[model samples]
Target: MTQTARRDVDPSTGEAAPPAFESLDPRTGEVVGRHPIHDEADVAAVVREARQAQTAWAELGFAARKQHLDAWRRMLARRLDEIAGLVCAETGKPLDDAKLELVLVIDHLHWAAANAEKVLKRRKVPAGFLMANQAATVEYLPLGVVGVIGPWNYPVFTPMGSLAYALAAGNAVVFKPSELTPGVGAWLARSFAEAVPDHPVLHVVTGYGETGAALCTSGVDKVAFTGSTATGKRVMASCAQSLTPVLVECGGKDALIVDVDADLPAAAEAAVWGAMSNAGQTCIGVERVYVVDAVADRFLELVTERARKLRPGGEPNAHLGPITMASQVDVIRGHIDDALRGGGRAVVGGEHSVRPPFVEPVVLTDVAADSEAITEETFGPTIVVQRVRDADEGVAQANSSRYGLGGTVFSRSRGLELARRLRSGMVSVNSVISFAAVPALPFGGVGDSGFGRIHGADGLREFTRSQAVTRTRFAMPLNPMSFGRSKGTVRRLVRLVRLMRGR
Candidate 1:
């Protein structure tokens, strides 16, 4: 590729842009790759082609779509390792984590392709007693085209939760990958294009926020966004101007709870992994921990040991990878400073390297429940651990945040009950965010965490609309409001409603 090809620019505004942006190896400051993307018109052309292709693809029956999806899934499985390597290079996640994410992505793709027809097939519905002559059957139909605004963290796995389902439901997809990981996005589109070879069913656009805004404003049927709540609100506002519907999987201030009867070792292990994995860039990463007052000290000791053992930088074999975005270092440092000033003690690794991308894991204890470290989504390898009066307080503390994303709970007997009580989209009982591994469960959140689900049956239905059709069989003996309506019929309807409602 020429030097001009290795550049990044927002095609919408036509402003001078970065020819190349460097992706550093988190373990070392060495450059991983210099990536570039197509401009605004280029992105628009891709979307236009996808729109034309969707018309023909949608005409095909569900069986044809399923056949294509199966072929794509087989191709992806065969090349999973190649995709994982691209993910690792772009997002700086550990090799194993990248592979794990790919596995889940494949599973979701399989589930969506196999189950869309079942979940979305038309079914007979009662048209109400008043309209007994009218028959109703509701079936889900594709939405023509879908726009996916994805995040840098879990680039492939998270977005595919939406992308795969959208395609399986017969919608052409236009994706804008996070600026930090554009390569993976391009790779995904390229792979799918090869599998189909007939149409531009999967297209990608690369650039900064303006490119993303362009996708939201483009005449797509709906937008599926996965990013911070602050940015999600912007995407929603952009789509609102066009009267377009959007699904946001926004940021989360997720918490982990350790009860008095909890296994201290297991809880601590979960805490360390939940906090520091992917340098704590995960949306559902445990930002705060609430432990029973009785076991708080013991839990802290165990967590600190685990936190210290985790190293963020080395080579491919490193436990943690460096922070991919340069801007996050300051944010992570600010949270640590605020926690220390708020009377929180550094029980583990509070001090970061003060170097380039690599951020050390920091575990703080005695943090005020209302402190920024405890209340906010840090999005780094830092954790705030606090003590609670009991399980009730733990549940309350966890629900206090505006975000209702995924969380974890550890208890001996009441684990399941407490897990359900906490207001979150998904919960892992006695485990650390294991729901992402279970393809049967639905993922996504409510409130500031954003709406619309991904994964399972709900995920498959998100990309389609309900198409209701009524096929009249035999006319009812009593025709409503036709030539046979009378004043006595109206009175009887009111009496029936009152009787049914026990008025």
Candidate 2:
């Protein structure tokens, strides 16, 4: 067979194959890179390799592991531009935004490495009076190997939330990045190899949804997934077969609430950025806006003005790049059409603005609460604004969604108070999506937004299993734990309990 023929056929089956796929640039639809479409066997083998590597990795202990992680962070920081270039080419995000993402990932890596020892160390605990003769302690142990199926948007920052924390917690990682951004995944694996050449502490597996399903069932101790709610459900179902624990960071229809006493300009600027940035591909991106009627018109005016000034392009001055996923453009357009058809008015760009890869910022007003545009996760540069009687009504409307991920509240005096009333996992008062940038804050949501955290102290513990240890400190005067305990001993224990309770 000719070279071309060989390339088109599977060598083992001697038939046409589908074991390879291409990554395309969203800006021009050009092929960026080609990667293997890993299957179940490939995923299983990689996981086995990770399991082998994890033993030596866990043996290295926190001090030694921290050294390797620190080296990796330093390497990533020095080559931030290079990786940012790959992210830009693969995800069609502006280079500046790509750099911003890399900066956050690097900071998380440093935080994970520097704090792992403090967070995961074995600590002593006082034994209860009932077990006064024993010493109690608890320590976190690595879960062996971890499987992380990452998202296409924010591929680096989102997955690294789990990958960095998992590694710092001393578990080996097998990463299956979104097929659209395999090059970014390959870059991370290559850089990690440079940091710790002897062990495959981090491995990359590339493919489509089937490949992700493989990872979920590949017998890894844990799985961390970031994607749509539908896909998260599938991942959870697959992991259930093996009883493997999973951390899911799924979809969100987050809202930005503007109280009557809020800063109109600041809230407007924040709403525009939070909704339109990254082509509104953020899981925590603002999809709906609830403004008190007292400032609804002014808020709408300010936001529309800002939205009109922003553009999506490959230029430096552009506020956003193209929609990273081509299919998302159709979804965005559908939501816009649904809103307009349902009597909503487009204050800025409308359905015609969605042209394939590029979707101009869209601002809609007076959209029905039950409309798809307001109810669903419109992962595009579009947001719906609704007028409410007061902050109470605004909060009520914002909390009427199935998702409870991240949210924002802009109020000069009642920011914190109003934010506390929102049913989201993280809410930024007087800011937009600021919680994601803080490494010490936990990030995750409830309901359809999914569960488990990816940052902060909780994040480190997610990849580990708690192991409690108890040892006899000395002989007890009366041993209740023994079956040989006399009836008199039981009576004495009851009397002691009653006396302690002040009965």
Candidate 3:
């Protein structure tokens, strides 16, 4: 195939020519599989099918929806390995990490299904005495269609946070998986179809950025996007054309804080795993570390040693896999070079060895807080360590970024207090990224990290609309809303207000 043709091939009619997207081993550039996809028109056809399916799916009531979700959950659990391999093949992450992603997704799936009805159920609202004869209630209804634009890293877990919740809340989904890992998305949709066999409630579309843009403008009710902040803005703008709501799970320059009273070994281990796991492709990964002055050198030494042990390669048993997307290698290398040129010293694997796309894990100390490596989201197995005078300084520096997705704090005596002070959606105390496993907690961020949530009760509400209903069962002698109210009624209203206020 021609290089340009090999890059992408859109379908001509409703049927596609063949697989257009190819998964490659970053280390050797060997093709793993060619992911075929239908054309843009076919994508629209899928959305239309989903729209048709949603009418009946939404009417299935919370119990029916939960049953469908539970069936799919069982199927996913039974074939976890098969799905995990697809993730490993496409994103080039270690098999264990891929399995970890699937494990986390199961928790979210279960929570969303079990809690959707309670979170979206209708409840009575108290009306004042004047309207006491009327009944008022509020409920949440599905928004019909939800479009999800997912990222490649942590593909299953990350996007499922939004996808599973949206589904449980009774909305049909049209997911546009990242071009890098289309097969994983396809597999997920196929699995869901097997469980629900009656309709195409969950559909998958594979393409590049253009496909995502088409989804935003393709009349879906909402778009849940997880990618870079720059691209998030564009997605928001495109959605604005139709005033479509979006939940953006964008990039994060998360931080880890170590207090003077922290267990040095435990804190260092958390920092290393937070920054180097999944080759540091996590949106919530710890990109920066702030250690108290008292144990700065000790913590850095321990973390550097641990990071050195996690090397990126294409082998099945490698600790870290090659950079999933080739473009990320350049970004990782650039950040390391910038940090080095800007007065940072590398304590461990800072340079790439002889590998096609595998970049070594990098650990740097004395990096300027204002340097690109410290300030930006490098999305690589690189850590920038800085010494803070105290825990207060660590908190301030951690909240300095525009992004606030995830954070970590390690303190033997003050884990909870410090975890609360960190400005992020969820923080791990003493450990790293454990908040994702606890499906009861909401996951998302404030500011540039985007709004709305994707877990717990908050996530269920994001996919449904609040519906308020009021009905009068009896007549009020002094009807304030009616023009027949007398002067005596106004006086009575004022007296009632004064009595209620205890004035």
Candidate 4:
């Protein structure tokens, strides 16, 4: 290609500037793909086009939608490796990790498609004795269009939670992927089009925060966002101008609590994997551990030993990949520095462990409850372990955060009880991040973790509106809703109410 053809020309200068922006492979900072820098106008145009496409897509009904979704699933399954390569290239996650995410996403797609009809179809309800002549029914109807702002972490799986459910519920989607992983987003939209070629039922608009803001106000029926808590607030604010409803899955400082009777080896392994996977960029990645004093020493020894063996690199066998967002390395280092300054000791990795694009797993102990590492989301492959006098203190410290997202508890007897007492939206007993793999469960959080669910029945309903219909089967003998009711009828109605009330 010619030099000018490879570059973006400035409209006013009539000279070649540079391509708007590029999606880079985090592992080596190599350009994966180039995309246009879409703005508000661009986002609005796509949303309008999606709105036009939604009419026919919605009319296709549940069975037809399911058929298309199933076709897409088959395509993904058949070409799993190809797509997983794209995921790894753009996000720098291990190939196996990318495949695992796609596997979970496929399961969710099947669940949403198979259950949409049952969950959203019209259902009849018995009318009350006083209104026995009326028939009442309720159903969920599709919103015209939904705009999804997806995060870089688990780009396919995370957004598909919104995308698949929204389409199954009879709505079109206009997605705005994180600029850091636009290639993955574009690949998904392309695959969907191959499954259903008639229209743009799923469209991806690529750019930065500005593009996401535009989507929030693009007149879509609802917005589904997954990102930092601070950015989620901004998205909500932008949607507020147009009075649009939104579902946000934001940041979390998720914790894992270990009881005195817990399985120390299994808990330690889970803690290492949960906290260090994806270079610790996971929204639900474990960031803290509250262990009972009785077994704290053993637990720490096991976790530290496993954590030290992990290394972040571009190799195929590497346990973790580079940090997808380059800027986040600084944030991770800052949290580590703060933890150390607050009198915490790093048992595994420390300040010297963080290098550009990679951060070794760092385990801190004795971190104060008020320390930034404990209070705020570090979003790195770092875990802080604290010794608690008992399970009560462990639970109390775990619930002290403003974030109430996903958490884990390891206990033989008190797992369920302690899980119920924890303040998070979802928790796993003796397992780490297992709740996200189950397609039947609703996934979301409260407090700083954000609100509204994105999986299971609630997720399907999030993209639709509930509609109630009441029809008069016959004229009532005592019609309270009629203006032509006689005094005798009113007197009888009062008598019936009084008799029912035992007056």
Candidate 5:
């Protein structure tokens, strides 16, 4: 297959054929599947087709849409193992982890389908004393279509955060999965087709960065992106040209804070698992640690013990898996190398830990606060452990990063207080990344971490736009909106305003 967009000549017709790319298994560098590289024209055509499908899908009403969604959900459940196998093959994650991701996707799909009406259906609101003669209502209407650019890590769970909710809100979706996992994206669309079968409510277009960029400017009503912050900016710029709105869920340098009175073993376990799971490709994965001096040594000892024993392989019993993206391997190694060069001590795996696709967990101690390993996202199975004087100092260190995406705090008495201090968008008390699984919590970051949210009530509304409407129930004797008002009418209206205000 052509790596670039250069066309191949077809001998039968003597015409140029579109380019294609291959999705490779990171474990063995073997080709899993090949996908067409959808260009700008192809993306535009898909968006136009989605718009036509969206009108009928939206007219199906909330209850009808939910029924179809429920049918789709059941279909997914019956074929859960099949879909999970596809995820495992393309993304190189262990089968168990792949299954876990599918479970979350199914749960979010159920929640979004079941709750879209209650959360987004038109509802009545009070008109207040001044507008008592009017009936007011606010409804969230579908945006026609949405474009979802997903990541490779947790491919099923992460993209569904936008895809399922957008569909539930009555919008057709055009999904562009990461180049590394295009096969998974295509599989989802095919299964959705089996359930609905009437229209292309969910469409998948595959390729590299150019394909994703094409979707942004393809006239979709909105775009939801999950990737690095740098790429999110580029997507935003492209969407701006078409006046299309975008929701960006970017990378994070998430931190876990350990207090003096915390559960040592649980904190250690959560940290290791959060930082190293799926080869640490999680957008909200824990990357840094700030422990109080009172328990720093104990926490470090426990975390080191847990991280050391973890193994990365394609085996079912392996604690972790290979890095899905090849480019990320260099980024992970750079952070470890920079940290060590800056006088940080390696407690476990170090510069030699990166072994091509699989990187053993690396635990660092006494790392400088401004080191790239602490400031930027590592997105690998490496973590830096820093000691602070107290919980207050720990919060300060955790909030130092420019990215405020998600965080975790392990404290007995002051869990909430410590969690509240971090600048992160979501913080889990005594648990790592707990907020992400809950279908009701808003997920996204502030500043460089990106903007907008996906999941929960907010996520349901993210794919739609709000519309306010009012109707006159009865006419008033005063006729305040008329040009025939007397000079004293203004005085009477002022008195009425005071009366409404109880002045």
Candidate 6:
């Protein structure tokens, strides 16, 4: 913990070694691990290797691939704590939270492996009356090679949403993990190698933005990216060169709605946790709350009381953790300052609560709906509570955002009714971030929050392309498709069609 970052030096030349990136411990600024800075050529070679391996992998069929994936899943489950410790050290999150995310990753891996066959296997499809002489079938085929650009937050769980599902669908993967968390990505790749030693189906390339861009342009069949919307646009641009499809999961200004008849205490607790947990680094974290006027005052009181009691620290008992990326501190502070300057006031922690590497929970009220704090994705431990006239107003406020990722609702009567009105990809009723825990539910969003899906049947299909096949079972007596058809034949075909339509 005491050691900071140190560069690799070549003893003979007395100079730095090849370019590389280091993973720093956010808590103490210590260099936890160092990885190579893979350039464009390196990325291309790795993708080529993966492409070569994909043929054998896809040929193994579903059962053999699942066996290997299951082995990898077991290894991850058995060594959960070891990997979680690395996650905790690199991300500055609590050990328990790291373990929780890893558990979800394992569950998703198992689900992807177990259900890939059922979801992707060729199935019989009925042909219409005109094509009754032909047998039709459809199946999802692997895209050969997939490139995954992972995120720093929830590094293991988030990228695995693409990696596991892709591998299960019979595709090889070339992962360019975030430079800030290369260690976790390397560990995952090593574990998979242990499970399936012969095939080099999974590869990890480590670097910064340039490396990610290289991955996008690499000769992979697809690229799955999880990061900011702006970066997603760049990825799409790069992929456009080769017409490679991309799946993007981006930022969100997610909101939580509180109805007039909501359980006030429950809503307050959810609000606090949703806005403050993991130091509010969650992409789908609740940044704003629109409460009904009838219960706004009491709900504000409860939220303020709970938020004040919480604090961020590196200790095991700390309610929250430090901001993983140091640069994001300025963004959080700027949002708070903007809120306060725009006639908004903090109910608990103020702008001064922003300590370096850590920020205390800040609950803001009276923030304007058009303000940056209200409309933008403030990915810090801050919450903005705005009052609304009724549930309809609350819905309107929640829906009025460019990013529709995930949301929550607290209501006794209209929980489901109001949830359906939300314009988000997923919504949880009477809870916070519950939809993400279920492996069956897809995790994705619409608009600027990014498109395509992960972590469900839909996720499995994202890494594949649908293919249709038809076989001629028998030939019809009427040779309608013949090139040398007589006028009598044409008249008979017309009569048959008219008779079929009850002419």
Root-mean-square deviation of candidate 3:
2.6
Clashes of each: 2, 0, 1, 0, 0, 0
User: Model 1 off-target regions past 4 Å?
Assistant: 1-36, 495-503
Q: Residue 22 CA error for candidate 6 (Å)?
A: 1.5
lDDT of each: 0.84, 0.90, 0.86, 0.91, 0.90, 0.91
**lDDT-best of 3 and 5:** 5
Write the number of the candidate with greater TM-score, choosing between 3 and 5.
Answer: 5
- Candidate 6 residue-wise lDDT, 233-335, digit = tens: 9999999999999999999999899999999999999999999988899999999999999999999999999998987898755788788888899999999
What are the models' TM-scores? 0.92, 0.96, 0.95, 0.95, 0.97, 0.96
Query: Residue 201 in model 4: shift from native, Å?
Result: 0.6
Any residue pairs clashing in model 1, and if so which?
A: 7-19, 11-40
Q: Which ten residues in a row have the lowest lDDT in candidate 3?
A: 1-10
TM-score winner: 5
Cα lDDT of model 1 by residue, 1-503, tens digit: 01123544569987767555555554555565666555667667878888999987877767788888888899999999998988887777889989988988888888888887888778889987656677889988889889999998899989998898898888999999887777888889988888988867898888778789888877899999999889999999999998999999998999898998999999999999998888899998999899999998899989988888988774666888878777778888888888888888887767554345778888888887677887778898888888999988999999999999999999998899999898999999999989987766889998889999988878878888888787666776444457677757667777777887655
Q: How close is candidate 6 to the true structure, as a TM-score?
A: 0.96
Task: Please report how far candidate 5 places residue 459 from its true position, in Å.
Answer: 0.3
Sort by TM-score, top down from the best: 5, 2, 6, 4, 3, 1
lDDT score, candidate 4: 0.91
412: Cα error in model 3, Å: 2.5
How does residue 335 of candidate 4 score in lDDT? Answer: 91
Of 4 and 5, the candidate ahead on TM-score is: 5
Q: Which stretches of candidate 6 lie over 4 Å from their true place?
A: 1-16, 488-503
